[model samples]
Target: MIETIVFDIGETITRDDRYWASWADWLGVPRHTLSALVGAVVAQGLDNAEAIRLVRPGIDVASEYRAREAAGRGEQLDESDLYDDVRPALTALRKAGVRVVVAGNQTARMGDLMRDLDLPADVVLTSGEWGVAKPQPEFFARVLEVAQAAPEATLYVGDHPANDIFPAKAAGLRTAHIRRGPWGHLWADDPEVVAAADWRVESLTQLARIVSA
Candidate 1:
């Protein structure tokens, strides 16, 4: 039985489009331009950082972060940032005796933000907390450790085919590709990749139905 579920937070449970708009605002570009740029990056399997740099030449990624820190202007994650289906799906899973876990490539600050939001999950973890990031084997290993879960009995849900589905499958967990995120939508036509997923859902609510079925 799949009693444990490890979820990638961004674009999976979190509504990240707002942040994409925030980035466009910061870069002084129309929101749709950044949206199309991100779609192109994912479609080409290119690094999104490079796309950002191209959009804003002379962008000092680190320096910009420090400037934002100095300004105390960080994009905050709150309940408002969650997808419409997140709570309902998590509640359904929890009521079914499943242990839901948030495991993702996120900054350490995200851990606290999630905690403050009181998500309907048993435990929350992040790349910064684990000192590792996904697509890296160690990150999944650590999540399994914390959950005390057998990989085969765990379901890993995320939005990226490369970063989430492929890596989780390699780690021996069932993989679910959520169809809403950039990479998931852009990469959906790759039969080789999509065929490998144990499950796919248009929305988290659909995930609830899948799990129940």
Candidate 2:
């Protein structure tokens, strides 16, 4: 039985189209250009951070983030940003006695944005507070520790195959590849990679139906 469901924040539960769009605007690139570049980076199995550096040479992420924060220019996630299936799916799982958590590679500052959405997660955590981010063994290891869950019993739901699916599986967790977002649909044609997933769910509603959670 799946005892816990670990969620990916952006593009998984939260529709971050506006978020990335804003990033493209700030970086002076077409939104689609930035989007395609991110996908290309993933397709090549390259690190997103390095890709960002390569795409826009000398772009200072931290400085841009700080400037946006000071100017209140960053697009904030609202309740409407939640996907249509997010609430119903998570609610069903929680009602079924599943432990739901929001664990992502975001900062503690992003926690405020998550709270604004009023998501139905039992616990919300981030890399900033945890001091570790995804794709790192310590990140997954620590999450299991906090939930007191055996990796074998945990189910991780995410969009990115490499960052989320592969790493979660590496840590001994079952993974569900939700094919709605970019990374999810990005690798759809790659049968070998997609087939490795324990489940391929197009909608959170479908996932709720199949999962014991």
- Using lDDT, give the best candidate's number: 1
For each candidate, what is the lDDT? 0.82, 0.79
**What TM-score would each prediction reach against the true structure?**
0.92, 0.89
| Location of the lowest summed lDDT over 10 successive residues in candidate 1 | 65-74
Off by over 4 Å in 1: none
Clashing residue pairs found in predicted model 1: none
Give the per-residue lDDT digits (tens) of candidate 1, residues 1-213. 787888898889887777678778777899999888887777788866666777988898768756665777656787789988889998999898888999898778878888889989999988988889988999889878876789988999988877888888998998888887787777666786678789877877766666677
lDDT accuracy of residue 9 in candidate 2:
80
lDDT of 2 at 76: 76
Residue 169 in candidate 1, Cα distance off native in Å: 0.4
Model 2 clash pairs are none
- Give the Å error, residue 102, model 2: 1.2
